[model samples]
Target: MGDLSGRTALVTGASRGIGRAIAERLAADGARVAVHYGGNEAAAKETVAAIGEERAFAVRADLSTPDAVDTLFARLDEEFDGLDILVNNAAIATSSDFENTTSEEFERIFTVNVQAPFFITQRALSRLRDGGRIVNISSGVTRIAMPEIITYSMTKGALDTFSRTLAQQLGPRGITVNTVAPGIIDTDVNASWLRGNPEAEAAAAARAALGRVGRPEDVADVVAFIASDDARWITADWIDVTGGSDL
Candidate 1:
């Protein structure tokens, strides 16, 4: 049996990109995973198919709405008796820089990225089993200066703080809360600017000490370890999966 055999995990935004990778990895580790998506039902189905129908199912919720947490957990309740892992990997980013970022854009980003995860966790506490794992997907932008995505970085920073504080509170219940921050991952989200553009990709790769761009699996592998029993003693820490970026 795998390290996470018989466990149940909820990976938000698992329809694509890093979230999809994490969902697949967790399923490979023998955890039945709830693949949560914002609106892409087709992509969610693909994720489930990749993980095997028996081991994965898709749940949809537009996290920007106030009742999203309730909606998500209500569906989740129908599938699993309790949750062993909660990966808060759902988030959105805007291209607008600090000067061009309107108040509306800022609010929207914060609502989906920060508020959703906060309320989702609060509601999940009751369903989360003792000795459960909570992994939040943050970004290296929180540490590196990226003014173009300042608002996005701010949301991740808040998430990091949440992980640390929540870890202390949940320790009594044997729940471990930690954040994984990724850098320069080559996913569809970055395809528009980094995929075909060799110069941009080269620049990004050079920033990392490893001299290569990161992949979704790079982050997923770290998350799988963090979610496993081996990481029970590790909590409230920001583990960087950045390929030694800016080091």
Candidate 2:
């Protein structure tokens, strides 16, 4: 049996991209996974199918809504008795720069990327088992200067702070709260600019010390390990899954 054979994990935004990869990896490790999606029911179902219907289920909640956390956990309560891992991976980004970013855009980004995760975890605490895991998916932009997505980077920074502080408070319960920051990965989100554009892809690859752009699975594997029993002592840490980008 896998180390997480009996565990149950909730991976937000598991409908696509890095979230989907994390959900698949967790399921492979023998955890029953709740594949949470913002609005894409089809993609969420595809994720479940990929992981096997028996091992995964889809839950939908538009995290931009104020009651999103309640809606999410209400659905979750119907499926699992308790949660062993919570992966806060749902987020949205805007390309608007500092000067162009409007109040509405900033609010929307913060609402989905920061507020949703915060409240979701707050509600999850009671359902989370004592020795549970909380993995917040952050971004390398928080470390590297990306002026184009300055607002997005700010949200990640807030998430990183949340992870560290929450880790300290939840230590007594044996709950580990940490953040995983990923560099550029070749996902659909980056497809418009990075996929067919050979020059752009090459430039992104060169930034990494590994001389290659990261894949969703690259970050997923690290998260799988962090969620396992092997990483019980690891908490409140920001683990970089950037493939040594800009290092």
lDDT of each: 0.94, 0.94
Q: What would you estimate as the lDDT of candidate 2?
A: 0.94
Once fitted onto the true fold, the runs of candidate 1 whose alpha carbons sit more than 4 angstroms away are none
Q: What tens-digit string does per-residue lDDT give for candidate 1 at 8-97?
A: 999999999999999999999999999999999999999999899999999999999888988899899999999999999999955488
Give the C-alpha miss distance for residue 35 in model 2, angstroms.
0.3
On the 0 to 100 scale, the lDDT of residue 74 in model 2 is 91
RMSD of each: 1.0, 1.0
Q: Which pairs of residues have clashing backbones in candidate 2?
A: none
Please estimate how well model 1 matches the true structure, expressed as its whole-model Cα lDDT: 0.94
Ten contiguous residues with the weakest lDDT in model 2 = 1-10
Candidate 2 on 108-224: residue-level lDDT in tens? Answer: 999999999999999999999999999999999989999989999999999999999999999999999989999999998999999989999999999999999999999999999
